[model samples]
Target: MSPRIPLIFNSRSWNWAVFAVLSCSLFSGCALLPRPRGLARFPKGTPATKAKLEQVKPGMTVAQVEAIFGSPGHTSKGSSHDNPPFLSWTNEDLTAAIIMFENGRVTQRMNAGGLK
Candidate 1:
């Protein structure tokens, strides 16, 4: 004749393991969440100030332009000697504009977002 033995497992151990994993995951995800860099660094949709825009003029040098408008959105110098340089300013809110210079003076101003 053979004798049979019964086995016992604690369900609380499984519950504890699950709770620990969930707690760790929740805390870790919160720690990993991205934080805002800062206002000075510029974020999306930063408004353009009239004071800054007024400082720009057609014939101003690149350095002068930077002083007035911080830094340009972009700059490009063409390979062809006949081509003039360009400067662009952009609002993070999708407001777009361009100022064109000829012989170091502003010759044209374009605004796509209707800025006067």
Candidate 2:
């Protein structure tokens, strides 16, 4: 049988292998760091500001409004194609905003409870 080769940790090749593994493990650790909360794209249960509500305008679609303010908290009784179906959103403080839709497009917007 052939003689088995010995591994010497002091050798240059062994030192390079150790260094490469350490460098890779150190760099990979950065990926596990937590991101800052302020950078969140969408925050849940956030109050709608007046400026956000103002983004809703006449002629915008129901889907478009939902994209801006999320889903409506309340919907008036009417069919989707009704002459003036209403959609409304309310914050925890009871500040509320309303939108009127006709033919699947915005007709008007109203707000109450000092939205700002």
lDDT of 2 by residue, 3-115 (tens): 98887976977855674465345435533666576663223454666887899999998788878886544333346544547666665444566676778889777665567
TM-score of candidate 1 against the unseen true structure: 0.41
Task: Give the range where candidate 2 is weakest over 10 consecutive residues by summed lDDT.
Answer: 22-31
- Candidate 1: lDDT over CA atoms? 0.51
Model 1 per-residue lDDT tens digits across residues 12-97: 56754664465345435545656556543234432445556666766666566556656544333434334444555655432444
Among residues 3 or more apart in sequence or in different chains, the pairs in candidate 1 whose N, CA or C atoms overlap within 3 Å are: 58-105, 58-106, 59-104, 59-105
Minimum summed lDDT over a 10-residue window in model 1 is located at: 39-48
After superposing candidate 1 on the true structure, give the runs of residues whose Cα lies further than 4 Å from its correct spot.
1-47, 72-84
Top candidate (lDDT) = 2
RMSD of each: 23.0, 23.1
